[model samples]
Target: MDDVIIPVAFFLILAGAVVAVAYFQSLRNRERDRQWADAMEQYRVVVERARTEQEATKLQLVEMSHQVKALEKLLLSVD
Candidate 1:
């Protein structure tokens, strides 16, 4: 009886330790997931801003090309 009781107590203690470790590990995983989500959101925002800026720059370049063409025609007419 004594031998059986001692082994049972030891098993219970070991199970408790395992549960504690698992709980802490889960918490760490959740925090890591949260940080990853935050980083992804930040990346999305930066990409969107870059796309918008690129479109604006394209529009400016097109307008400049049209103006330059008009100036060239004017110069040719003067000659």
Candidate 2:
């Protein structure tokens, strides 16, 4: 009876330890995933802002080109 009891107790303790380790590992993985998601969101916001700025610059360049063309026409008429 004593021998059987010792082996049973040992096995129970081992199983409990494995469960504890698994639970803690899952919590760590969840935290890591959350951090990665936050980083990705920040990157997305920065990219979007850059795209908007580029579009504004392109528009400004187009307007400047039109103004230059008008000036050239005026100079030609005067000559």
Candidate 3:
């Protein structure tokens, strides 16, 4: 009886340790996942802002070109 009881107790203890380790690992993985999601969201916002700025710059370039053309025509007329 003593031999059987000792092995059973040891097995229970080992199982409990395994369960504790697994639980902590799961918590760590969840935190890492949340951090990754936040980083991705920030990257998306930055990309969107950059695209908006590029479009605005393009519009400004178009307006400047029109102004240059008008000035060139006026100068030619004066000559």
Candidate 2 residues lying further than 4 Å off, grouped into runs, are none
Candidate 2 worst ten-residue window by lDDT: 1-10
TM-score of candidate 1 to 2 decimals: 0.91
| lDDT values for all models | 0.99, 0.99, 0.99
Give Cα distance to truth, residue 6, candidate 3, Å: 1.5
What is the lDDT, from 0 to 100, of the residue 9 in candidate 2? 99
Clashes of 1: 0
| TM-score of candidate 2 versus the correct structure, residues matched by position | 0.85
Regions more than 4 Å wrong, model 1: none
TM-score of each: 0.91, 0.85, 0.86
Q: Give the per-residue lDDT of model 2 (tens digit) for 1-79.
A: 9989999999999999999999999999999999999999999999999999999999999999999999999999999
Candidate 3 residue lDDT tens string, 3-79: 89999999999999999999999999999999999999999999999999999999999999999999999999999
For all candidates, the clash counts are 0, 0, 0
By summed lDDT, the worst window of 10 consecutive residues in model 1 runs over: 1-10
| Tens digit of per-residue lDDT, candidate 1, span 8-36 | 99999999999999999999999999999
What is the lDDT for 19 in model 1? 100
